[model samples]
Target: MAPKAQTPSKGSKKAVTKTSKGSTAGKTEKKHKRRRKETYSIYIYKVLKQVHPDTGISSKAMSIMNSFVNDIFERIAAEASRLSHYN
Candidate 1:
């Protein structure tokens, strides 16, 4: 007569099971929770006003400065492109 094979018991530390899909250690929920980002301090406008000269240090002014910087960068990039094309 042939002998029967033995199976290991479950719920023990030695017991091995397939990992659950999309589930990571300590995070049981199928959906990964995004950590809420802390809001930036309102002092940014005051800081910019201290650093930037002219028409007040309001957030609106800072936005305008950002746009001006973008425009200047675009012009510089265009000139560089032209120079590279000639080269």
Candidate 2:
């Protein structure tokens, strides 16, 4: 048994209701626009002394190395800021 088409007097275009759950296609694009984590580098010098086997690297050198690393980090930050402006 076939059901009959109950047309609204015929010749009327069907209405397309918008989807309730919206589109998910644009979500991945939003994720791509997000910022990534900050990158950093570290350098450690390990030298063992035979006289004082427990002795590690010099404290003065460690301070100097840390300062140098921090300076480089600042430069990287500045460049990143500049790039962000251009983008």
lDDT by residue (1-87, candidate 1, tens digit) is 223222234443244434543345447655567998432324545565578846455567666666676678789999999999997
Structure candidate 2, residue pairs in collision: none
Instruction: Kindly give the stretch of ten consecutive residues in candidate 1 with the minimal lDDT sum.
Output: 1-10
TM-score of each: 0.39, 0.38
For model 2, the stretches where C-alpha displacement exceeds 4 angstroms are: 1-56
- Most accurate candidate by lDDT: 1
Tens-digit lDDT string for candidate 2 (1-87): 123355642423332222322245444444356787432222344323445667576677677766777788889999999999997
Clashes of 2: 0
What lDDT, from 0 to 1, does candidate 2 have?
A: 0.55
